[model samples]
Target: MKGSQLGEENGRRSYESLRRTAQALETRADIARAALRLFRTRGWAGTTVRDVAREAGVSVPTVYSTYGNKQGLARALADAADLTAGVPRQLAELEAAAADPPRQLAAMAGYDRRLFERAGDVLRLLREAGRIEPELAAVYDDGRVRADETRARVFSSWPDGTLRPGLDLRAATDVYAALCTVDVYTTLTAERGWSPGRVERWWSDALARELLDR
Candidate 1:
């Protein structure tokens, strides 16, 4: 009887611990989502840790302890979005289609479209906020560098005759990155009221014309 009671007590404690860990993960996700929404609607400078805490239905200390600060929260939000969006899988698909330059470029454009659709406002807010916050500025610059590198790699994978005459791999990558930026997406879809499908088609067509021989 004593041994059975001890085993049941240990089991109960293990269950409680698992429950607490799950709740913590859920709380963190809630906090990240709240921060992202606030950042998108209010702009980074306008949104505060208190705002996130309130929006997340948690205390300020809890937000602070969980994420450290607003910058931390923003980073967490970006990380969560990236993980949820499965960017690596998209990149794999793009790489696999590299033998077909037009198809590869279209896949790249499609990836950009999906990224912007998921987090355009958040990215814009981060860009604006980065001007004032050094940490965020670093994060923004790192993202740009990574994007440029990815574009350069994709451009490099193509055959010599693919790009327009007089355009080297570096320049082509630069142009491609600029054309597929979140800012352009926002301008076309949010400001100019172009449909998402139209934006995607435009991206595919523009990249094909600019980068491909045919």
Candidate 2:
């Protein structure tokens, strides 16, 4: 009888610990979301950890303890965004159309268009904020490297004899990366007022003409 009672108490303690951990994670997510919102609307220079805490409905100390600092919270937001995952999934889907290089290029452009349409604002905010924040700058640089690598992988996977004559793999990859950057997306969609569909079609046609044989 005593053993059964003790087992129940231990189980209850374990359950409580799990509950507490889950609650902590929830709080952290709340704080990150709040910080991202403030960063987007207020800009990085204007947003503060205290503002995030107030927006998240948690105490300032909790925000600090969970994320360590503003930079830490920003990093957490970047991770949560997982900007790296979308490209690979899109590329993988392009495998089925690999036999037709033009079609594959079009698919890639479609992917970029969708990605920017969904996250362009957040990405622009991060890029602008990185100018002032050293830590965020590093994160932005890392993201660029990852994006470049993805572009390289896609170029490498192209069927032989498909690339335009005289364009080396490195040069071609560089051109593709440059053409499909967040800056270009922002300029076309936000600055020039081009529609998302128009931008996607242009990218598809442009990339195909630049990278593939006539």
C-alpha TM-score for every candidate = 0.70, 0.68
Candidate 2 wrongly placed segments (more than 4 Å):
1-32, 48-68, 80-92
Best by TM-score: 1
Q: Write the per-residue lDDT of candidate 2 for residues 89-115, one digit (tens) a residue.
A: 676667877677778778778777876
lDDT of each: 0.81, 0.79
Error of 1 at 141 (Å): 1.5
* Tens-digit per-residue lDDT, 1-214, candidate 1: 6999999999999999999999998888888888877876887768899999999999999999998977787675665565554677778888688698788787778777877888776666667778888877776777778777877888888778888998898888877987988889989987999987789899999988887776
Off by over 4 Å in 1: 1-34, 41-69, 80-85
| TM-score of candidate 2 against the unseen true structure | 0.68
In candidate 1 the C-alpha lDDT for residue 51 amounts to: 95
- Candidate 2: minimum summed lDDT over ten consecutive residues — where? 79-88
